[model samples]
Target chain A: MAEKAKILIIGAGKCGRALVELFSKIEKITIIGVVDFNQDAPGIKLAKTLNIPTAVDYREFMNKAGLNCIFNSTGKAQIEEELMLSKPAGVEVIGGCSVNLIQELIKEREKVEQQLKGLAQRRNNVVGNIDAGSTPIIPKMEPPDFNKQVKKDEDFWGKDKLIESIIQNSAVATFVINSQHKVLYWNVACEELTGTKAKDLLGTSGHWKAFYSHQRPCVADIVIDNSFVDLDKFYKVYRGSTLIPNGLHAEDWYSKLGGKDRYIVFDAAPIYDTEGKLIAAIETLQDITERKKAEDELKKAYTRLKEMQNQVIQAEKLNTIGQLASGVAHEVRNPLGIILQGVNYLENKIPAKEGDVFETLTMLKDSVKRADKIINTLLDFSRFTNLDLRPEDINSILESSLSLVRIKFESSNIDIIPEIKKDVPKVLADRNKLEQVFVNIFLNAIQAMPEGGNITIRSYGKKLEGIENGTSRREEGYFMIGEKVVVVEIEDTGVGIPEENLKKVFEPFFTTKGLTGGVGLGLSVTKNIIHMHRGIIYAESRFGHGAKVTVILKIAE
Target chain B: MDRKRILVIDDEENFTKLIKWNLEKTGKYEIRVENSGLLGFSATKEFKPHLILLDILMPDMDGSEVAFQLKCDEDTKDIPIVFLTAVAKKEEVEANSGVIGGHPFIAKPVELEQLIDVIERNAY
Candidate 1:
């Protein structure tokens, strides 16, 4: 009997439990104890059932009698280092990954020894039959290249055991096929990934069962066939194919294997014999589903970041325009003031009896007045700060603002229609500034309906879902999903805004009315004031029909 | 018994001339114009005006600086100053009886009647 090796296991985890199961079955090794900080670990519970001793610390067994090995399964390098530094002489420390490797090697050695014993027994039976003058017919089972001189491929793969083990243990799924599409090499990793055993697939041409339900040419089959034109007929819609050194690479989405879709990348290369004859083709597959998912998410995030960047740039441009307008308005007003006074002086000095002279002065005076109005509007649009906020009724503000323009609208033969929803919520806003915003919009509606049409003022309060698509501009500056808001829609039945001009309606100095007194600042100033109130205002129109201007405001808490 | 004497100081020549002509046209006052603040300050001593109409933005010295200097001087300290500016809001000027900053400040391009009303209210 061999000398029994006494060993201790450290860190009772899954790995430790596995080691215990393997070491317990071995005849030459005896487990002294299993140690773990967690007393209730799965491995510790399993060791207890086997009557093995358990401890919270393994240092107590450092100098134990007859201990030959200490297996450190902790996976922590520091703990393994400390154990190695303190191990007693004559004891071996098999730690970390090598512990599992040693366990596998021991099982392999046992299997090989059993096979040798069976071969020896068969040889004895054959010799006895020969003595009786009886020849038994046995199938020839020999490794390839038994009669031929060492071929290049046989010398490289068959003779080299290290390369054979490397191919068997490769992490990426790989398989080799002959010209007949027969699988010659199916790695262990490939079996684990496809849930097919290598023993069943080897020497068989049914390798397509791993990826597809029906018979189809895999990448390795195409390499063996060497029919490049058939690639498009078989895999017509691959992502792309690249020519690598002595290989072709392609990636595509595969779903025939009854599971979640997988984006697999595969490379195929032809293996040639020493005389340059094609012997086999090998194909390697790598699952890139997670990496592709992360890349798509990053692309979406980058797109959102770019959109925010554009909005910031637009806001900066608006700010610059506001500053420039303020400077220009101030400079123009002084000269305009002087011109107005001069015109007034001339009007007084010149006699009214001189027809053209007095009329021309009146026209000049009117032009100066018009210029002054434009400058004032420009100044108003730029100076949107120091807002006075208070909780005020939207209905009352609409009513008062309408009253300011009611007389003008009535004189132009345009009917005024007020549709105020009762019990509307109050909004936090500057009462005077909000009034100015309503007044400007009302005046615009009135101007749009110059040919005697009805001006409808609709007011209501409700919770608005996020702004609808197609009108993204209204929600760009300010709005949250599921916001409580009060809406005032001022619709006019007149020549509506053109589709092309609808986007430009809120822009400064963009007006459809030519020669008419549409300074174009009415909607622009209204937008500025509403923006200051943290509200939204937008216009919807049909070219030949009428236009509707909607204003949305947040409800005060 | 004598007419009200006024001194108008502004950088705009045409504007001051129009104000002088408009005020003198009323036949209730005699007005003198000066384009520069320093020149206008000296004219105050020689003209001995009852009231001063000053422009806020001037070349050499602004209206506030001139007002500070006049207030410091013994002879000119009693003279009331009205600011004529383009920056003042028309409605604000009208709401406060045409007076701004405790003194009358009229928005420029004022109507003749409105300007006379502001002058009468502050000149005394």
Candidate 2:
């Protein structure tokens, strides 16, 4: 080899940079320098890194000793002319079409090299599989050559198949959609979750069919469209995922999925190409129906526990009030008895005639009676001890209560309607106490309807299903579910209790009635008696639409 | 029928005074009043009353102890004793047929006619 040729490139653009890279590997040519007007050109920066000289002007390398060749890739005719005239004697200048031709050949060689690397990788994989005791199925075909470009394309497509299979066999429900919103991949897990085979949904834009009755964008479609604002319109609970960038996680309850209601949590993210352009979106789904049911059950249990705690507090409060009332009643009654005796003695001394003297004595006597009545009622409310529990007919008790209030009903123009069921089961309750309970309830019903409304007394045997007790004071597990019980419902078309006061009716001294209402201990005593029998009593009212009170007691075995 | 003698025992002096005034006004009975159970037990021996109206809850000595002492004496053992109390409810006395523990009981604050009816029925 006569002396190696020292070449200088006139441009540092893409083509010039490619030529520099290609020539740097040639054995017969030495890169003398790279020249471009812009100091930041790609080819100049690369040449500097390789230890080759770089210049802003081609004339700086023109007189360099033994510089024998010049390649002008700038595509500017003025630069080519200057390079040709100023080149050293016996040096050659190549420009225009010749440089363009060389660049094409260099790109072609790069493509061939990439194909050969892919072939080598495929060969190594096959040998590795053979060593792992797996039979290798080699394709029977002609040997690979540069001209067989389709074979190299087929090899790349084989890698795409591997990705497709991996997604198809995954345990999580997954689907993919192209930029046009067409379904591209609906995997086996998606097929099972939606109860729709993959073939019907593969090429169709029917992903919404799985979750909604009408067509709407799923989370994956929203991600592809970059429409984050639309998430609220579709999902009730959703938030951005912390684990994945540009991904969304959401939970929703679908009324009908695979013929049953299902709660699902899903995550969707956009897939981007190497150029950072959004190409498709992938979404995964998980069925959370069982978990949602368990959560609901836990919440209900917590509410029941709170109610039981309140009941215990209420019982203790009632016991304290009872003891206090008992003591006070004993002290007060003695004085009341003495006053009545004094009044009686005065009545005998006075003449047996109607006069101011006689009226004054009678008024004094009546006042003592009133005070004694209040004391008696208070004592009744606090006394929860003596219960003569026996298996007794609830129907007969209801009838007796109705009879006791019949005079009030007739005087007030109220109508009594008894819908007493025959063959009703007997309840384990004290007869007199149960009678008192019904009488108090009936009296309340009578008082509520001052203008005379219908009082419906209905009694029947029922199996408790846990919903019979509507009061929040109900203790959990007090009555076993499905146990036989006697249900007595007394409904009145009276001035219904205000909604806010419904729960407080059973509380002592909680009365809407004024002083004439007998101290508000009637229902309170009634509730104590019913609770002593291990029964449940609650009231429901619609303010002006009248009220209904239900009482449930265990049926005698 | 001769006027029957009645003895009233109670811790409240006003109550015993009121009972004596009311019961004597009827004219069918003469009344003796004692403010303490111990004094009432002593009064029963001298008063020789046909009936004794005893109050159950007294501070110094209750009616039960007074009745036990009176019954142990041969002179007052045969006299009919009635318990008039404020502690027992009227409904409870009526449910027990106006008698409890072998003695007739009357809830206090009794009207004159009802008190007269009970005294006449139980008096010897």
All models, DockQ values? 0.27, 0.45
Q: After superposition, how far is residue A375 of candidate 1 from its true place, in Å?
A: 0.7
Return the lDDT, model 1, position A214: 85
For model 2, residues A1-557, the per-residue Cα lDDT tens digits are 34666889989999899989988887767889999998789998889889999999888999999886788989898988777668887676777755775676576557656655776677678789899989885744322443433333233223454456656876778888877777778889888887877788876889898888899999899888988896788998887653345778788998868777889988888876545567778898878799789888988998889877867877787787778777776688788878888888788777775899999988998898888777777767565457777889988887777788789889999888889899998888888889889899988988898888898989999776665447333545558777888888999998898888988898887888897676778898888888788888999999999999998888988
Interface DockQ of candidate 1: 0.27
Worst ten in a row by lDDT for model 2 chain A: A149-158
TM-score, structure 1 vs. true: 0.53
Which numbered prediction scores highest in TM-score against the true structure? 2
lDDT on C-alpha atoms for all candidate structures: 0.77, 0.81
Look at candidate 2 and give me any clashing residue pairs: none
